[model samples]
Structure formats: structure tokens, C-alpha cells
Target: MDKQTILDVLNNLEVVDQQGGDEAWMLVDVTPEMIEELDHVGVEKETVLKYGDDESVCILALAFGEKYANFWHKGQLVNWPQEAVDLIEEMESALRS
Candidate 1:
């Protein structure tokens, strides 16, 4: 997806858990609607639908979320390319601007 769209998604991410820390929070499971929206905004259809008919395609998008991408990959939830990670990092940096 484009920078703004990714940023928008990150900005409005749904909270799932407290992550057992005072300030750590994890994003909620990504719903089909979220997948559809991301797909509409440039995320590949195959990428979003890869989870089959799963009701929630989970993602972690808070700070340090990039490093956790590997976990998603291991779970077969995502296969993020370096380019995608770069885009996400860029979007994350933009938060400081």
C-alpha cells in the first residue's frame, strides 16, 4: 500500500491486548473488511487473501512492529518483502516528522 494509507491504518489500528507491559499494546486481528480496505488501497489481493477465509488476519503494527514481522512470516500470516518493510519503516519515521 501507499505511504498515507499505511500510515492511516497504523494510526487507527485497533487495540487487541496490553502485551503485559505498562505501555505496550498490540493490534487487533485484521478483519476481512480491513483486508478489503487495504486491498482497495493498493495492498495486493493475494497478499490479503492468503489467509484463506480466516476472520482475522492478525498484524502487529505498533512501535517495533517491523522486527515482529518475522513472527508473522513464521505463522504464515504474512510474507513481507524488504520493500514492504522499508515502506513501513518510512511510514513509521514519518510519525516523527
Candidate 2:
């Protein structure tokens, strides 16, 4: 989806910290500028996992230490599986509908 479409999807989401873990659900508000940044970086919204609430701008799962390095080495971020991204996108699509 395009930037505007992603923004619309994000606006309708709700942030929640499932399991009360360190994971945070951030529904980062996407501005035109933010969209430009993501586009510049070649990171698609569908590639990211949604975290917290609709009011949040972006959700991030963080892991610190050697494990983090290992995760990065494996092309994953904070243990976020590829399936999670797919799930988030599906939920976002449903929310929009």
C-alpha cells in the first residue's frame, strides 16, 4: 500500500502491550515527512509489525545484548518473525475495511 493508505490503517489501530512484556505497541503517526523517510529507506509498512495503540506512531520490539546481534545477523528485528508482519498487515487491512 501507499503511504496515505498505511497512515489510514495505522490511525484505526489500537496499541496494546500483550503479555505485559517489554514489547511496546506504538501506532506511530505517519506524516508526509515520515512517509518520505520510510520510502527513502525502502521499508514498506507491510514489513513492519504493529505494536501498541492507534494513537501511537510506531510499535517496536526491542532486545538488548548478544541476542540482539544474533537476531540482526539472521535478518530479524527483536525476534519479530516474518509471520508477525503478515499478521499485522492483515489486521490493518481488516481494520480499514
Candidate 3:
């Protein structure tokens, strides 16, 4: 998705991280479907949710990480992998609501 599309998907959230980045930030609790979707991208273990625009590290959008690293679900962050990226269209749907 394009930048604006991503913003819209995020409910037009303007949250920033500690570094004041424009991307929305949140700690998410993973669902079973999230794990399954992530698995399709070969993410079997825990990983980091590096922003697609983080230049200090390899930007996800520059690679396939964008598809797998997108996290938008809001939860208690329980029953989920730590320091991992979550990619599931279901997440976006949950967030939109």
C-alpha cells in the first residue's frame, strides 16, 4: 500500500515512537490467524516490528517485510510472540473497527 493508504488503514493515527517517527506505534497481542499468516512468510520464530521507514535498520517496505511486519491490532499483548512483527489483513480489519 501507499503511504496515505497505510495511514488510512491505521485509522489516520498520528502516533509516534520514542524517536518521534511518523509511523503509528503499538504493542500488539497476536492471534492464532496472525501466527498462521506470518508463517506463510517464513516467520516461524519471534522477530522485531521494524518500521517500514526505519533507515537505521533495513526498512521493511524496501523488502517483503512490509507485507509481514504490518501490525495494527490493539490487544493486551498476551498469548503472542515477543518482539515479533505481525502481518494479517484481519489485523487491519480489527483496527478499522
Candidate 4:
């Protein structure tokens, strides 16, 4: 996916529980290399929900247990590296999920 496509996905994502007092947030940049990692961990785009941002890059809002993580990437989701995908999956499973 290109930068615009990734931004669209992130912008359109739905937040399950934004009220969670202690939630972690992460903004991840997806790339082609990351696809393998996502596939390995079985993470789908539906699992993610995006929010508003004030930057040129894609913004990923992840909230978990009083911790909010934001990831800013200049590249597109389709070009994300495997390491990036793995990190996202790990965070979702261990923290968010």
C-alpha cells in the first residue's frame, strides 16, 4: 500500500474502547516486508483502528493499560518490514488484546 492508502486505513480504523483509562497506543508504518510478519502472526487490517493526527505521515493510535503509543511512519503499509509487523502483532496480543 502507498502512503495515502496506509493513511486512509489508519484514518478509517475503529476504536473498540477509547475510554480505557490505561491503554497503549502505537502508530505503525506498514510496508511490503511487513506483510510476511503480519501473515506469520495472523494479524488483519480489521484488527486495527486509527484516529486523528496532525502530520504528513500515517498515525496509529494504540491504547492499553494507561499507556498510549503512537507510531509515525513516512512509508506506506505495504512497504513495512517484517520486524515492524512482528512488533505490532506482539503489542496487540500482549498489550491490547
Best by lDDT: 1
Please write out the lDDT profile of model 1 over residues 18-91, one tens digit for every residue.
35334533445667666666667666545544433354433443213433233222222343577886786687
Candidate number that wins on TM-score, 2 or 3: 2
Query: Could you give candidate 3's per-residue lDDT for residues 57-89 as a string of tens digits?
Result: 222231225443344345211122434434454
Q: Who is ahead in lDDT, 2 or 4? A: 2
TM-score, structure 4 vs. true: 0.24
Cα lDDT for residue 9, model 3?
Answer: 28
Regions of model 4 farther than 4 Å from truth: 1-24, 48-97
For model 2 the TM-score comes to 0.29
lDDT for model 2: 0.39
Clashes of 4: 29
Give the better candidate number (1 or 2) by TM-score: 1
lDDT of residue 27 for candidate 3: 27
Residue pairs clashing in model 3 are 47-83, 47-84
lDDT of each: 0.48, 0.39, 0.35, 0.38
lDDT of 4 at 39: 32
Model 1 has an lDDT value of: 0.48
TM-score of each: 0.40, 0.29, 0.25, 0.24
